[model samples]
Target: MKLTKRLHSCVQLEKDGRVLVIDPGAFSEPDAGLGADALLVTHEHPDHFDEGRLRAALDANPAAALWTLRSVAERLAPAYPGRVHTVGHGDAFTAAGFDVQVHGELHAVIHPDIPRITNVGYLVEGSLFHPGDALTVPGVPVETLMVPVHAPWNKVSEVIDYLREVGPRRAIDIHDVYLADIARPIYDTALGNLGRTDHGRLAAGEATEV
Candidate 1:
């Protein structure tokens, strides 16, 4: 499979001429999920689920579809009919020719007073796992793990520990939109030295074979 990293948490995967996009949110390019055969949203957070972008993508390709949890699915399903599907933990489906297993239940808590919301990760093709906004361990073997390098709900210690726990053969960074450029090397050094796996990141629009 060919994996292309988009800004923030969005990623596009291609195999056998089919494209599946995940988390094409507001922080990502406005047209981030366009041309996808299918799209997956992890949660309702604006950074993870931009309705306008998703609607536009669906409009551009009549055959395209979206899979997401109830909170997000309800917002678009009414318009798309059979094209929008609701999914949750323990669910498995094939999208754009890639096998996807849904994992995780809620987003990481931002604070003691802030309420947590639904969030689901996707283990695609049984090889790569993207845990959206949480440090969810899929409990199944993974070849490549998409690490949310930085976020409000987590710190460097948690990220390193999550990496140690999942122990994939390789890892690439995602959900790093707010990490300042000057502090990037700090994260790089920490995760690279302590993540204990082949870990790295790709610039926006960069692609690598997995």
Candidate 2:
């Protein structure tokens, strides 16, 4: 499959003429979900779920479906009906021609004062894993891991450790719309120094084979 990193946590995956988009949020391009065969949303956070863009995509692609947590599903189901499906930890299903397994239950704690919200990572095709805002380790082997390099809930050390624990063949950056160009190399170098795995940040809109 080919993976293309959109703005922030948005990722587009394509294989055999089908397209699967994950987290086409407010931070992503307005048309990030365009032409998607399926959409996977991790949570209700604005950076990960943009209602406007999602509505537009679904309207444009009548055959496309949405898979997400209950909180999101509850709000969208009325409008889309059967097209919206709810998934939680350990649930597995097929969408856009690829098998997907859900992991993690809640978003990383941003602060004790802030109530935690639902978050679920996606393990696609048993090869690529996107953990959204959490540092969830999906016990099975991961070939290409999408790491949230920068987020209010995590630090540099946490990212490095997550990569080590997952031990994927490659680590790609996600949740990086806030990273400054000056600090991008520092994070890239830190990921590269973790060991034998290939690590790099994918430029927005660029596609790389995984």
Candidate 3:
């Protein structure tokens, strides 16, 4: 499968001509199009999700379906009929021609005062793991790890630690803040042996193959 980062938290995964788009929201390009056969969302936050964008994508590609958590259903079910499938942590479902496993928890750090909202990540084909907004790593090893590099709560050390735990053959940093380009040199220097995307800083068009 080919995995590439799109706008913000969005990622495009292609395998055998099937495309699965994940988290096409949060600090993303308004015009970016994720040619997805299925859309996988982790949460409902603006950065991780945008109902309008999902709706627009669905409108543009009627064949695409949405695989999301129950929290999303409560909010989006009224608008999206016959297109939403709810899955929870530990659940596995097939989409985009691969056997996908759903795991991880919610983004609790967003607001220190309140409890965390429900969230989850995806393990695609048992080789690629997209943690969405969750900070937790998968129990099983993965070939490639797609993680958020820059966020309000994530630090460089935290990102590095997560990478070490996952121990993937490669790592791609996505969902990074647009202004944190200064960390590139630092991150590259620190992650000397581990893989990092060589695309121009903040540009989401480039991809590295494993």
Candidate 4:
């Protein structure tokens, strides 16, 4: 499969003429998830879920299906009916010709005063794992792992440890809207040295084989 990283946490995966998009949020291109065969959202955060873009994509692609947490499903399912599906931890299903297993339960704690929200990561095809905002480690072996490099809930040290624990064959940087160009190399180098894995940060709109 081919994976294309969009701005922030949005990622587009394509294989055998089918397209699956994850987290096409406000930071991403407005048409990020357009024409997708299936769309998976991790949470309700604006940076991870944009209602306007999602509505537009679903309207344009009648056959596309949306899989997300209950909080989000509660809002979209009423409008889209059969096209929207709610999934949670341990849930497994097939969408857009790819097998997906949902992992994680809540968003990383941002602060003691802020209530945590639901967040579910997707493990696609049993190989590629996207952990959304959480540092969830899938128990099974992973081929390609999407690591959240920069987020309010996490630090570079935590990222390095998460990568080491998951130990995927390859790791791709995600959730990096906050990172500056000057710090990009620092993160890449840290992951390499501490995590001891092949890691890369795909530029926005850049596609790479996974």
Q: What are the Cα lDDT values of the candidates?
A: 0.96, 0.93, 0.75, 0.93
Q: Each candidate's TM vs. the true structure? A: 0.99, 0.98, 0.88, 0.98
Q: What digit string (tens of lDDT, one per residue) describes model 2 on residues 10-116?
A: 99999999999999999999999999999999999999999999999999999999999999898889999899999999999999899999999989999999999
Clashes of 2: 0
> What clash pairs does model 1 have?
none
Clashing pairs in 3: 26-47
Write the residue-wise lDDT of candidate 1 on 4-56 in tens digits.
99999999999999999999999999989999999999999999999999999
What is the RMSD, in Å, between candidate 4 and the native fold over all Cα? Answer: 0.7
**Model 4 Cα shift for residue 139 (angstroms):** 1.0
| Rank list by lDDT | 1, 2, 4, 3
Q: What lDDT, from 0 to 1, does candidate 3 have? A: 0.75
| Per-residue lDDT over 1-210 for candidate 3, one digit per residue giving the tens place of the 0 to 100 score | 776667777878778898888888857766443567888898878887887778787788877788998887677667778788998889999886878999887773866877788889899899988888777677997887776777776776777777777777777677775535666777666654443322222358665443
**Candidate 3: misplaced stretches above 4 Å?**
193-202
User: Candidate 4: which stretches are off by over 4 Å?
Assistant: none
RMSD of 3: 2.8
Q: Score candidate 1 by TM-score against the native.
A: 0.99
Local accuracy of candidate 4 as per-residue lDDT tens digits, 1-210: 999999999999999999999999999999998989999999999999999989999999999999999888887998898999999999999998989999999889999999998889999999999998899987889999999999999999999999889999989999999999999889988998888789888989899988
Which candidate has the top score in TM-score?
1
